[model samples]
Target: MNDMTPRSFDGREYPYTPQDFAAVSAMVHAHSGICLPQTKTMLVYSRLAKLVRERGLRDFASYIDLIRRDPAERQRAIEAMTTNHTKFFREDHHFRQFERDVRPGLIERLDAGGKVRMWCAAASTGEEPYSLAMSLLGPDPVEGRVIAGADVAILGTDLSGAVLDVARRGHYPAALSQDVPLDLRQTWTRVSGGTMAVAPMLRDLVRYRRLNLLNAWPMRGRFDVIFCRNVMIYFDEPTRERLVQRLVDQLAPGGHLYIGHSERIGGEAARRLRAIGQTVYRKDAA
Candidate 1:
């Protein structure tokens, strides 16, 4: 925006004008619901600059024109710009709450010939859903018991197909496994070549699918608990509220919804849910 701000990058002087930045930001928000503030000018430049080069474009203005013309390229641009940082058992306190208060009730349903349904709304690279799988169906691999073999299912979805590719592979660097408890880690991960592969049992418990939070969801029925965490921080309030309401509709009565620790719901969406814990809310059973 100004001389001090990063208008240029690498070795080249940034040729795009402020109007160019604004247009790109507006297009991204309209397509993905992620609000890129003017402060993120550098971020936008950093993420898309390579694409400009790859496209053989001379400047950001030309790059924007190409994205306008090509739907596939636009999708690729969205993938390139998205921020995907997640870990196993991230927001540990929420997992603690689930293991204690939530699991017991869901166990009751399992005992009644029902299945425990959990959805990781943004299953970045597979960690969150796998951690949830371990928590839902215990660490041990007993095939027909209270948990280790209980009737449970998890659905993991994210807007980014590239990250979803990583998710389906079910592997992560060993260092990233630290957030997982020792027993669960040992039970669920097979270590080799310095990366941990999630055990078949755990992987089998969850299904990974590509989902755009701002687009139509093909899912049916409701979930006992839904984790739609830090993904909303990039969205403006109106977009956030709309997404929250849709998530609420997919939640079973009295089911829990987990958002990012720093994210919140407002207006009618806020009224339908009551705070149960940090960034966790319970839908009114009525």
Candidate 2:
């Protein structure tokens, strides 16, 4: 075996400085809620470098400038940096909790002349909201339930436009149906060319829109359940506190909030919200 180690053809190693890493990390946090760790410097450089090369930019700094100045370029960068690691019912327990605990409570309130509204914040590529749609509407399915999925990125915001072109088509691998029960799979989705699409009836119950959680939320009306799951972990404590409070504001009295398993809202803020179970919170009626 040769003693020489592998090296770049140009003999110039990639330069990843502390400042350079901080700049990109800050940009990511500003645009999306994702917090890039210091260890992810290499990942940021490697992934974004491809964009720089594709756009014929000379370096990372130039690419950042271009993205900041150009709306379309910024959108591409937002899509690139935002984590899209979601699958159908990724956290099964949450869905189960929705069915067993939350849904019944919601239905009781709805029966007493109330309406149910749900927001899926950080909805990536449509799986989370679509899953919620299926669960809330149930098998028989009725109209008029309001389910909204929102994201800050163009790919997420324009979900009704070019962003949803693929999602509207509703194609996922057959393996995705593995978690969904046969009855629900048959009721909510249909297979075409070994892919799955949410049924039109169920799709009509949910609407996808562009929303930036960091900015003023344009939404009107309080919600019975807000599925802001797997998102708050990206923010620093202050940001998290602010976002959590905003989410709580939108929640109707006695409403429910679902977050990622790894996150928590503590102290006085935690007092306003009572823990229902693992990763679930109920807003105090008072």
How well does candidate 2 score on lDDT at residue 115? 63
Cα displacement (angstroms), candidate 2, residue 171, comes to 2.4
| Colliding pairs, model 2 | 157-210
Q: What TM-score do all the candidates reach, one by one?
A: 0.92, 0.83
lDDT of 2 by residue, 94-204 (tens): 888888887666656555665677888777667777777667655553421332121111112321233445555566787788767676687788877887777876566
On residues 159-229, what C-alpha lDDT tens digit does candidate 1 reach at each position?
89999999988988877878899888877788888998988877888899998899999988899999998
- After TM-score superposition, what is the CA distance of residue 209 in candidate 1 from its true location, in Å? 1.3
Best by TM-score: 1
Error of 2 at 89 (Å): 1.6
The collision pairs in model 1 are none
lDDT of candidates 1 onward, in order: 0.85, 0.69
Which stretches in model 1 have alpha-carbon errors above 4 Å? 1-14, 143-151
